[model samples]
Target: MRDLAELDDRVTHCAACPRLVEWRERVAVEKRAAFRDETYWGRPVPGFGPPDAAIAIVGLAPAAHGANRTGRMFTGDRSGDVLYQALHDVGLASQPRSLRIGDGLSLRGTRITAPVRCAPPANKPTPGERDTCRPWLARELLLLRSTVRVVLVLGGFGWQAVLPVLGAAAWRVPSPRPKFGHAARATLPATDGGPDLHLLGCYHVSQQNTFTGRLTPAMLREVLEEAKHLAALA
Candidate 1:
């Protein structure tokens, strides 16, 4: 929901969390020589999708082999394969194949962002890291002007990080609580509108989650359907 200029700036020189910066730098240096000439953004990578999207998809963070390598959120990762397909199936995206930067695909009515803009060491960011990244997200969301009708938090961590921004903070609790599932739906009052912008939850489409049968194409489609159903009124 961030303006393109603000989003672009964040992607260019973000330094909200120290741990992420260190890890991303390490990957940029220690990984294959193929990435040597490819300079790492070494900062918070902004969400990749439409600028005025109505559906906002939130991921945990960038991935070592994924966004860190390709400079685009969810790119070059197995997780993106399933997610992109689900988007296509739900009419939010063009048919998606690969996660490469050259994929030339874009979400039609959806935008994607992360709780932690930078890739964490093992994709697990500490609480402080998540907290530190919230302001920028707040700026983006507040600036979005309620155009976003549904926010899909891709996992438990993602859900927690998002609720506070939506002012569900008083009711939502901390970790080891709710598990991300196919039916997860949190209807939140819209920040601008007095009505709502539903927030659907899901197990991350990571290799671990998908391979473990925790998430599937059919399951993801159902959640997207919920968004579509809710957005139809708006």
Candidate 2:
């Protein structure tokens, strides 16, 4: 795609994976008890934020009832609750909540996206599905390469998924490849002589992590602050 607008438009219409298409659509129709009266997006979700973002937040995939219901990444979900609040606390978000599309929520110099565009069954996308969706992320990072200086990856799945995309974007991933861990850090040099990219890892803000006290708001904010510093946004 020539631009992020076109990329996002294309993403919403993607049906490349039959399984992902079926699962996302089925969940929309079945409707969770609480959201039965509301309409579900049941479509692929695109990255969120401005085109000139200096920082990117990568998550695993859209949640079945969360982004699937609201048609926006991290919207209407507990995971989003923790994430957006942390961004706001760190002065990167316009507001602390991501309720739905057009909620007036905005990220300053940051974009949030996932490796998988379509929400998968049981929150898991097969290896094939992740590979099939790789081009989208690759193109997105390429489009943002001029401005994106830092990538804050949430969880190991996103960490693993993004490394290859970074390489594809001309960022030289290390030979051994950096392992994933909370607060993990890696600096990837652009083979094309572009600005270097900084990668930061943090535990996902999923309910499992937040509820268990594994990923506190403070911890999340710390990472965001660090990303801002790395991106020169602070």
Candidate 3:
């Protein structure tokens, strides 16, 4: 189950990072007519799913025209359409469509979060911004510390943000540590409990990926199947 109140609290006044604060506020101002009467949270959006979930999907951050507008992760956007379809195929979601936060959809045994909570300009967050936003992820991880069996990183930055937090091993020149890619998996180096945090890397289902035909529903399902198996084992 999820605590709606807590989720609201986490994003209520999130200003741990300044650049994001300025950017979010600017969007709220420039795009007011669309969301004029609405009170845009324009802050750090928290993870969405069951609080006790063992499976988590981490994305880069909210898109100015996507989650940042809809006030829900993966809602009101084309990117979400692709992702939710895959979740439905993998049996993690009961609904095939994610129209909005109140569309009567639910994530079973899974949760979704972002490294940089607020939406950044051009959808690119600076390293300093990402680091400053780490505390939010850390707080969410601690809350989910009890049962995080698997992590699915949507892109390279998502992987980079999560790996260090999970304490995966590091190597010099040779770099024995694996790189992020479709189907890549690495066990945490003893930081997040002994259970292997099956890390599955996949290309983010962005407009570029989907329109370019780089990612198909079938390809997404294959990786999701691996995630399901790992979640079950964990």
Candidate 4:
């Protein structure tokens, strides 16, 4: 892809994984009861934010009723509620709520994306599906290689998924791959002699975590603050 826009267009058309393609489409047609009257953007969800983002937030996949319905990563969901609120509190987001696309929500110098663009059944994508979707994330990181300096990965699935893509995008991922943990940090040196990239880990903003106090709004904001500092946007 020549740019993020082109990449995004291609991503939306992707049907590389049969299982994912079927599931996302089926959910779109069936329609959740609360959203029956609304149109579901059953197509693959693309990353959101500017092309030259200084920081990137990576998540596992589109939620079946969230991004799948809104066609924007992390939108229209409880997880998005917590995540965006934290971003707003840290001054990275223009608003605390991401109800849907065109809701006037904006990220200052951050972009949000996912490893799996399609919503998987039960919110779990198989290993094959994750690998099948790797090229898209790899291409996205490559496109943002010039500007993005910090990657805030939510949960272990995204952490694992992004590390390989980072390597492919010219960052030298460390040997004995870094383990995922809330607040974990790793610095990856650019193989092509570019600026070093900082990787920050945070617990996902899923309801399970937020409701159980496993991930608090304060904790999420702290990570965003750290990302801003690392990206020099603070």
lDDT of 4 by residue, 115-169 (tens): 9999999999998999999999898988999999999999999999999899888
Q: What is the Cα-based TM-score of model 4?
A: 0.98
The best candidate in terms of lDDT:
2
Off by over 4 Å in 1: 32-41, 168-180, 191-194
Given candidate 1, what's the lDDT at residue 191? 40
What does candidate 2's lDDT look like per residue over 38-143, in tens digits? 9999999999999999999999999999999999999889999999999999999999999999889988999999999999999999999999999999999999
TM-score, every prediction: 0.86, 0.99, 0.87, 0.98
Provide the overall lDDT of each model, using Cα atoms, as 2-decimal numbers: 0.73, 0.94, 0.77, 0.93
Q: List model 1 lDDT by residue over 141-169, tens digit each.
A: 66554466777888878877887776642
Name the 10 consecutive residues with the lowest summed lDDT in model 4: 164-173
Model 3 poorest 10 in a row by lDDT: 166-175
Rank by TM-score, highest first.
2, 4, 3, 1
By lDDT, rank the candidates, best first. 2, 4, 3, 1
RMSD of 4: 0.7
How many backbone clashes does every candidate have? Answer: 0, 0, 0, 0
Global fold similarity of model 2 (TM-score): 0.99
